[model samples]
Target: MNTLYRKSLPGTKLDYFDTRAAIEDLQPGSYAKLPYTSRVLAEQLVRRCDPETLTDSLKQLIEFKRELDFPWYPARVVCHDILGQTALVDLAGLRDAIAEQGGDPSKVNPVVPTQLIVDHSLAVEAAGFDPDAFEKNRAIEDRRNDDRFHFIEWCKTAFDNVDVIPAGNGIMHQINLEKMSPVIQARDGVAYPDTCVGTDSHTPHVDALGVVAIGVGGLEAETVMLGLPSMMRLPDIIGVKLIGKRQPGITATDIVLAITEFLRNQKVVSAYLEFFGEGAKNLTIGDRATISNMTPEFGASAGMFYIDEQTIDYLKLTGREPEQVALVEQYAKLTGLWADDLENVEYERVLEFDLSTVVRNMAGPSNPHRRLPTSALNERGIAGDDMLAAAKAEEADGLMPDGAVIIAAITSCTNTSNPRNVVAAGLIAKKANELGLGRKPWVKTSFAPGSKVAKLYLEEAGLLSEMEQLGFGIVGYACTTCNGMSGALDPVIQQEIIDRDL
Candidate 1:
């Protein structure tokens, strides 16, 4: 530890590295211009890097120089089963090599904290309409992946600094957001901001809580697991100023879909975007997470918001201990990390967005960034007007429409993690139920929230059954449709596939 910058944090017993003072010591008033991402990165360098190279490395950030690569020591590595399994299998191979070379195989272990979540492999074999879908699907998962599960469990016991949340828990990203990230991590009587590299691209989901979590490839995850510095250049830290409130009836999904289109068009590929202004402040943590979860869809590395009261509020809401929560707030304010402290942060480029301009939207016809208005999804747009008229006429004669929707899945961690979005969906279902309108007989639908707690909340709100009434019952709390694990299609649709030989 560099004692020159090490100082006792007030209101807590833990010591924290004074990143602001160190940055200012070299360039007065420059710390104030550093974006949130830069501040977090600088803190880690001050706390972890060699004193000899500290000044030169920080100067790289201070001057926006990308000529040479710096080092990033992420605090943790997070992984879902697919990529995590591949990385662990490699480690197992290395252990064998070590034993053959007369080295202690048991000594080989991850140097940094690592988490592996067994979430992605589950397929929804049991229909959501069945009340026992979750249990049944989980049983099927265990039966099919019996050998795979055995290995994952053995690795958890065999490896040091490794923790695993087994299958049927929840999506890895959601678990990270809800409970894993401390916001401010304390170790060895020292406190610092939490940062992580995940094996899945959507790891930025937890960036909603103001942590600098980003996704990396399988090899990068393994490197971080070994406590090696992830070599890097400073990303194009772009500032996004959200200026207006969301219009009435507009959902977080709508806002994200619009922003995804805008950011993609702005060519913010691989940039670190720091969202600020009144509009960002107004959003709840869940809503911010909804946007952050879709970071890759915008071709961005991370979507970050400054730590503020909203972050603290979310910690409390998610059942974080009060003392730790207070520590997070105090540390952020003292370290210039609070949203209020970053009024004058500078960015290489700034993008302007107005939330009120967004309408109810969805991605369609092709890619996730391909934004399409829901209003335009009707007959006059996708299908020809004359054909739609004929289809409607045919439907009136007690026949199925020519282009009826077969699947209406309410899925993805991107939207379902946001309470506001789910509540709005539930409310719509309630109203539709009251109106005596039900799901079409041929429509196969499911609702898969990223968190298991979603069921409790929806039941308390009396909306689960209403959703079930509309054929949108709870499926397994895992990434299904989005991960290509959507199991068997409806039987009717399957038979149609067979008869289509006509």
Candidate 2:
């Protein structure tokens, strides 16, 4: 049943084979157990395999055959500022190399459409306790990233098929979810599914919409942009069965923190996770997005929830035009991609989690998946009796001390995408202000939301000022304080940590 296919791509002769049949042929009863992701990859191989050696190649995925190699052509490339800047710097250097070798510098361009947004550069130098922390922090951002931004501007006009969204706009993944990706793309009177590889590990945030977005290293993104296929064997797909509903007052961030811990404990690294069950259907696109945005945190490749009503609803709510939204519904339903149609889908493995068990939580001193439940912080030593007393003593002396929560940053697309989490932080800030509580000076608080629209909603709710009062200001909407570019700590605080090695 192996079939051979040929395609004439620019600068390359492409071939595809019947990977499922190839695998089945190599070993009996193999394809049926393949994960949903593998099934899609097998189809990709079948469509792209060459007539000369198709069968031998497809045996890799189907029969657990890992001998031969296959090339996967993702449809697009996405990037954020940190890695994207470094990537473009590399490309610019590569252009230098090509020019040295007499290759046209102009000819070296991204073959696929590449979207690079300015994120990951801002740091919360001022806490929400400041009346204008956002503006102050933004000023600091401009000072720190002057070099990065200058080069990025050069990249815009110098490269073809590349679009840059400048700094202070929003985080990359949120922008993609909101405006960048059109679920079905139309060009030359033909329509195709939108699939992409991003430079950040959290690119799968858009996977909730069924776009097949994945996070790859900058090297992989560059390869894809150059029209080179990312070669790989299909990944293991794991099904996560969700049950029960989250309790009231629990944010999606809390739920995802718990799920991250559970899935990590289950050892679901590098696997494609497909969440199912009634509970998943009840969760809004926002909630699903929060979980999907944390794919890398759980050590998974892609966290996908099948395209369902929530997907369509979110598309409409985000102001997508009627026709495009209709197209998403039509294409998904017709292509057997609709959620209801996937009931019989099989997976290599399955794990179950209950939503009700999730409590208020925050992740990490370092890692995103290290869930620290608020209730157990004392037991865990993050909020011990001694630590509380130390903080109090520091406050009484009009100084910041141990366990200062140095950065209560409301940043990153991970938590900011969910209105509940964003609003919850604002509510907390508002309550703190009313009660005369304020963020410690050492705590550089910031509210770096991932979208301009987020500001609109927060303003509409009248919570923006409350956040600012606590020194949590609108700090140039970007991935600030996350990704370890926390900017320079306070001079005295830096000396203190250095002195104590704490």
Candidate 3:
């Protein structure tokens, strides 16, 4: 351990590595300009890396040098069933190979904490049109996954340092955001920033809490579980300066979709982004999470926000213990990871975006980054007034349009974690219901939020039934429309399509 920089954390008994002291000693005044990413990484290096190579690794961040490989030991590893199962199965294969060579197969166990959540692959066989969709869907999931689930159960007992969360719990990313990340971690009487790696790209969702989290491939996650440090050169640490406030009634989803397109155009492929400025300050942690969760869409490794009052507020709101929350704030401020501490930080590339300039936006028919204004269908000659008139008239006359909206889904996991979007949706649904609007017979509709808490609040607000009245019922979790799994089309619609060949 590099005890040279170890110091007492004033408010807590746990000791912390003084990253600022070490950095300033190396290069005077350089510590003040380190970005949030650098500060967290440098802390890890100071606390965990071999003392012999610590100075060189610290130089990788202090000088913005990307030539040499430094080691990154993420504090935790998270996974979803799809990739989690695959990684575990690979371990089993390795164990077999090791046993063949007369190696101790039992000794080959994960050293780092691993949490596997079975969520992503849950197929929505039962559409939300049915009142009992959640139960029916889970029943189908259990029956079909009977064998795979048996293995998952076995994995729970067989694997060391691994926790298996069965299906129907919630989305892995959401669970991580509200529960898994601590923002600050304490080990062996030493406190440092929490860092994590998840097999899924949306892993950055927890970055809203100021944790240094990155998404890795399945193999990378497996390697991490085996306690292998991620070998890395520094990525382009880009800064996104958010300015202006979001217009009234503009949801975080709207802002994120716009930001996703903007970041994609900036060619920030594999960059680590830090969002800050007045606009970012105005955003709630929920808003930051929405943007960070879409890291994959922007083709970035992470979308980070610094620890600030917002991060503290979110921690408390999500039910984190008071002591832990205090530790996060104190640690962040002390180690220069706090938002206020980053005013002088510099980035290789900086992008400026205006929150007010963005219109309420949505993505394309295929891509999340292919942003479009909600009103663009007419301008783009895709859906004109004539088409709308014809569709309404046809519906009234009991005739089906050749092209129809077959699937309607609230699939991006709002209402569970994001109250603003879901509340707006529920209000809209209530208005539509009051207007006697109903789901089209040909459409299979579903509402899948990441957490069940969404149901409680929506019910309390009398919006759940309002949405359900329009066929936007609580179907199940993990019904993401972006993933090509928004439940099956109605059987009648399928038959009609087959018969008409349209």
TM-score per candidate, chains pooled: 0.96, 0.86, 0.96
Across residues 392-443, which tens digit of lDDT does each residue of candidate 2 receive? 8866976657545666667878878888888888898899999999765566
Reference-based lDDT, residue 404, model 1: 74
Q: What is the lDDT of residue 189 in candidate 1?
A: 94
**Mind giving the per-residue lDDT tens digits that candidate 1 earns over 1-502?**
5677999998678999999999999999899999999999999989988888888889989998887677899988999998998899999999999999999998889998999999888887776677788788889999999999999999999999999999877899999999899999999899999999999999999999999999999999999998899998889999999999999999888999999999999999999999999999999999999999989999999999999989999999999999999999999999999998999998999999999899888785358888888787664366567777987796688665656776677888887888888988899999998999987766667888888878889999999889988888887888898887878877766676466531
Arrange candidates, best lDDT first: 1, 3, 2
lDDT score for candidate 3 against the true structure: 0.86
The better candidate by TM-score, 2 or 3, is 3
Task: Indicate whether candidate 2 or candidate 3 has the larger lDDT.
Answer: 3
